[model samples]
Target: MSRFSPFSRSRAPQLLTEVLSRTDAFAPLRAGVEQMSAIRRDLDALLPDYLAASIEPGFIKDGKLALFAAHNALAARLRHLEPRLVADLQARGWALDGVRIRVRPQAVKDPVPPKQARMTPVGAAALQALSEHLEPSPLQAALAKMAARHTKR
Candidate 1:
C-alpha cells in the first residue's frame, strides 16, 4: 500500500487550537492568541458595533493593551474612548494600565482605465499635410501611413 494515501489528503483531523496547544514551541504563541481573542471579545462588548468592528486587537503586554485602527481618524476616535475602554478591560481582569491605538490602514487598490488608441483630428490633418509637403521618400511614406492609421474611423 502507498504510504501517502489519497484518502488521507482530507481536511485536518484536529482543531487548530488543539494542534497548536500540543506543541511546546507554540505555547507563547497560543497564549498571545488567547489574550488577543479575549481583548477583541471585550472590546466588542464595550464599544459600539461600528467602532468595535473597525478596531483589531494587536496585543497586551507590560500593563498596556495595543489596538490597530484602520486610519488616523479611527485612531483619534478610539483615543477619545480609550479611558473608558481601559477601565472596562481592567474591570474584567485584563490587568491593563493603559490603551494604545495604532493606525494600520489596509492598502486600497484604485481601478485604472485601460489605455486607448486615439489621435486628434487636427493632429492627423497636420501630419497628413506635412507628409504631402515632403518629397516621395521612406520618411514621407511612413508619415502618411501613421497619419492614416490615426484618422477617426
Candidate 2:
C-alpha cells in the first residue's frame, strides 16, 4: 500500500511563492506611480484576474488601500460587491488594506479605441501626408500636438 501525504510527489505543494511571487506587491504598486506609464501592462501581467482590470490597488497608508475601478461599470459592480472580491483575494493570500474603488468616468470615454495609437503602414502613410500638406495654422498645430502626444513614437 502507498502512503498518502501532502508532501508526496503527486500531492506536493507547488512552488506557489515562485508562481505568484510572494514578495510584497507594494514595490510594483509604488514603482507604478513613479513611472506613470506602462502601468496597465505591468498590472495586467502580474495581478490576478479578479483584480486585474477590475481593481487597482493604491497604497497601504494608514492600513487602508486606495483602489480605483477601471471603469464606471466595474465601479458600480464593486460598490456593492467588494466584500466578496476582498474575501476571494484574501483566500488567495492577498493581504490588501480594505479595497476602495473610485469610478473612472474618463476611462470609459472610448472603450473600443486604443488610448495609445498603434498605426499600421496605411495609417502611417496618412499621417505623413497630413504632416506634409497641412499648413502650420493654430488648429493644425494643435492637431499635430495631439497626434504626437497620443501616438507612441
Candidate 3:
C-alpha cells in the first residue's frame, strides 16, 4: 500500500469541526445547520409520527422556513400544515415570515424481493406428468429437473 493515502498522512488528521471553525463563512453555515436541527427537533415534538418521519427542516433563509418532504403526498400534507408550522417555529423563537414545503425526495433503496415461492407437490407432480408426454428437449429436461425437487423422497 502507498504511504500517501489520506488516512496514512504523516500529520494527524484535522477534525472537520476544527477546519470549519477556522473558515470565514463557517459561522453562518454552522448556524444554519444548527437552526435546521432545532427546527427538526421542534417538528418532532409538534407533528405526528407519520408526518415527522417523512418531513425534514431544509433551511431557514430570507424569512422563510423551507421544509423538505419525502414525496408529493407528504409535501401536500406539509403545505396544509404550513401556517401551524410557522406558528410553532415562531413560538420556538424563530423569526420567520412563511413556511415553504418542497418535495425533496430522499434516495430510496430497492427493496430486496421476497424468497421465491416453493413449488407445491401437486404443481410439481403436474409438471412431471407433462414432462413425460413431451419428447426429450430442453423444456422437458428443465420441467423434469424442477419436478424432481418436489417429489416425495
Candidate 4:
C-alpha cells in the first residue's frame, strides 16, 4: 500500500482528443455557407404586397428557394416570376446556380412588395415612322415586313 501525499498535484496526463480540434466543433466555419439563403433573400423581398399578405421565406436547397404563400394565387404569381428573379439574383452576384422556386401554403398576412416602375420604355411611334420612310433596300424591306408581322391588327 502507498502512503498518501498531502501536497501532490493532478497526476492525469493532458488529453489530446480529436473532436476538440476538428472543424465540426464550430458550425459557422463551414465553407460555401449561404448565410442569406434564397428564400430569405428573394421571396422575402420581391413578393408583392397583394400576394405577400400571407407568405414568408422557407427552406433553400441546391439553389432552390422554397416560399410559403397565402394561397394558390400568390404561389402562381411567384412561380410566374421565378426566371426574372433568378436573373436579378445573378446580377447581384447571388449564389443561385439555377434558382428554383417551390410554393407552400402559409398562415399569416404579409407586407407587400414595394411598388416599382416598369424599367423598359414602351417603343414610341417615332421608331415606326422612321422605319416607314426608309428607302426599300433589302434590309428595309425585311424590317418593314418584320414590323408588319408584329404590327397590331
Best by TM-score: 1
Q: Rank the candidates by TM-score, best first.
A: 1, 3, 4, 2
Q: Model 1: per-residue lDDT, tens digit, 47-90?
A: 99988888899877787788999889989999999898888888
Candidate 2 Cα outliers beyond 4 Å, as residue runs: 1-51, 107-153
Per-residue lDDT tens digits of candidate 2, residues 1-153? 557765665755665434345557656654545433343444455555765757665654553445677777767766676676566555655565566667654343445754664666556556656866888787677656655644655
Instruction: Score candidate 2 by TM-score against the native.
Output: 0.34
Candidate 2 residue pairs in clash (backbone atoms < 3 Å): none
Q: In candidate 2, residue 131 scores what lDDT?
A: 66
> Candidates' TM-scores?
0.63, 0.34, 0.60, 0.39
- Highest lDDT model number: 1
Candidate 1 local distance difference test against the native? 0.87
Candidate 2 weakest lDDT stretch, 10 residues: 34-43
Residues 42-105 of candidate 4: C-alpha lDDT, one tens digit per residue: 5456656666556665445787755666677776777787788777766766666554445665
Off by over 4 Å in 4: 1-45, 108-153
